[model samples]
Target: MIQSFRNEKYDHKVEILTPISGQDHTYALLATYEGLAEMELQNKKMFEDEEYKELITEFFLQNIVQGSMTTQLFRTMTGLKKETNSQK
Candidate 1:
């Protein structure tokens, strides 16, 4: 669940497919760090001060959504095939 611009700019909610393995703390932390780095790279124009940028990264790093893409894709593909065969 993401709330942007005080719930006014983007109030829409999206359904996400989440996998099980990334729920572990190690992967979650690594993913969050990677995401923060990417954000810093992209939002370099918006934030000029290093300290403020570090604060933003700290907040995001504290909260990260963890998931495994491989597991979710495998489940979706296998489920689709199973359903198709059952229909036939």
Candidate 2:
């Protein structure tokens, strides 16, 4: 499933995270977009993809817990620049 997302070449970053300490049974798929517009566009593209739809129907819908998914969005604070190696 992770590979499917990467292969699609969407204009966003995707990461898969597993807990080191808490919630051992939980895994997370983190997708970072430039903004809400990008998120919506990418999501639409993803949903419209036939491969994605097949995977969701064949795998995710069967294995994942019903209603267990949750979504949260966060924005970086304005004026905060990402720290680079050169600035360290």
- Per-candidate TM-score against the hidden true structure: 0.23, 0.76
Q: Give the alpha carbon lDDT tens digit for every residue of 27-81 in model 2.
A: 8888878899989998898799897778767777676888988888888788988
Worst 10 residues of 2 by lDDT: 1-10
Cα lDDT of model 1 by residue, 2-87, tens digit:
22221232222223334577653432211111344544553463366565566556766776444422321111123444456668
**Index of the highest-lDDT prediction:** 2
* Per-model root-mean-square deviation over C-alphas: 10.0, 5.4
Candidate with top TM-score is 2
CA deviation > 4 Å runs, candidate 1: 1-45, 66-88
